[model samples]
Target: MSTLQNFDRRRITGPDKSLPPVYDSSPSAADPLASPEPAERAHRSPSSVRPIFLQTGLIPSASGSTYLEQSSQKLVCAVYGPRQQPKAAGAGYSDRGTLTVSLKFAPFSSSRRRAPNRDAEDRQLSLRVQAALEPAVRAETFPKAGVDVFLHVLESDGLDALVCGAVLAASTALADAGVELLGLVVGCSAAWVGGRTWLDPSEQEARGARGVMGLTCLPALGTVASVWQTGELGLEEVEQMADECRRACDELHHLAVKVLLESAKKRLGRS
Candidate 1:
């Protein structure tokens, strides 16, 4: 009898209220948003790179993993497999192992919220990563196997820089996983603004720039692995940007080597 009918109760909702307008209370001199002086801009170096922090073995469950940070950009990469290949009918056998790269941006990675599904940008970045890394990895070493690299961007300040960082991080993770590699892959990005090339550009600078380029290299081999560009630029400008990007990659290569050495030392000590 009680299940036959239910008593209805009216629910009261709170009235909508508009937020109060915010105002700056600080003096003009102390305002952070104020533009910098001409002298200050002249003194500031545009070619400087953001400090990089790289570490490995953070994910014990993964075959290999790395964490990389530069300014507000942060990402983690995990490498798995070189194990048995999947048995899917379409998964044709390869004498050399295949490299499958997947890149995802966390919902909070950017200023705006991102969806969990992979977008066109994400797919393109994944392809770029694979291209940059494939040359460096000795995939043929493991026959009929596959290596899976998963990159998760925790934060993103610049899309170009984020892709570059992911390239470096993924290669490092593969190496940490004990995968055979021809050479470590190092990635660098540059922004062409006002007829000048700025290396390792921040998000704001990248947005304001005329063009952006990302380069990945195999340091030991002294060869460029991949080059990606956006926006229009002349041949001369492209050459200049490429040269700058190569130099930056070389610098990053040194730092990456040091990090890997330190990580190996720690592992040896533990063993």
Candidate 2:
């Protein structure tokens, strides 16, 4: 999968030579081609996440690829391999294949440009995504092969949303790659603020929240797979956040499945 192996990650910083940037969210941005920011987030409801757009198979050279957007945040995921397991120092034989996942942010993804290299937060988010999706993949099916998932955050609106979106995008990319899967994983997040849980908070909105949470699940199986929480929350509030996030995840799963089904039908017709 040369496309996946050679995806244009390095040029992710500037506007595409042909297309105008429609996802920039930096407050200080002055690019005339950059789309205006969405309406003030304060007007959004507490029970809803931002509306989203998802599409797959965009990278013809990759086994599978997908791009997803929710207002200001844009993420792309590419999957490669089911090929040779790289023989590294002291590598041992394995009955199950391995999955190597990395998440990186484009330098201009945030208001304050991020470093191009992976940082501590990026590593942490990568592990969280890996842990959430591993349970759904039947890795033994590939034996000595491996699958590599690469996630590029082209833009970001919030830390919680970034992680949640990464999990959602990666799982969809794996399924699109035709990997053996026990089930698909979906993610949702919320912030506890003003004595209530905000379904999905933007970075600007979450600044003063008392707590934040991110949850991932296998909606088809009705089971939660991972949970990440921060700040101090009472037991009652924690329970509420989990419940809200789970419901949101289920809703997201329905939307994701619908899109995947439609894409599959089109592919079948083309074949």
Highest-lDDT candidate: 2
Off by over 4 Å in 2: 1-41
Encode model 1's per-residue lDDT on 113-213: one tens digit a residue. 67678456788889989999999889889888889999999999988888889998998899899999999998888888777888887666666677888
lDDT of 2 by residue, 1-271 (tens): 8878877766654544677456557654442224332222366888899999999998889898999999999999999977786688888888999998999988878877687664668888789899998888899999989999999999999988888888888888899999988888998888887788888888866665778888889999998888888888898998999999999998999888987898899989953
RMSD of 1: 6.4
> Candidate 2, 61: how far from true, in Å?
0.7
lDDT of 1: 0.84
In Å, residue 262's CA in model 2 sits off its true spot by: 0.7
The lDDT of each candidate is: 0.84, 0.85
The TM-score measured for candidate 2 stands at 0.84
Candidate 1 ranges beyond 4 A from true positions: 1-44
Residue 21 of model 2, lDDT score = 53
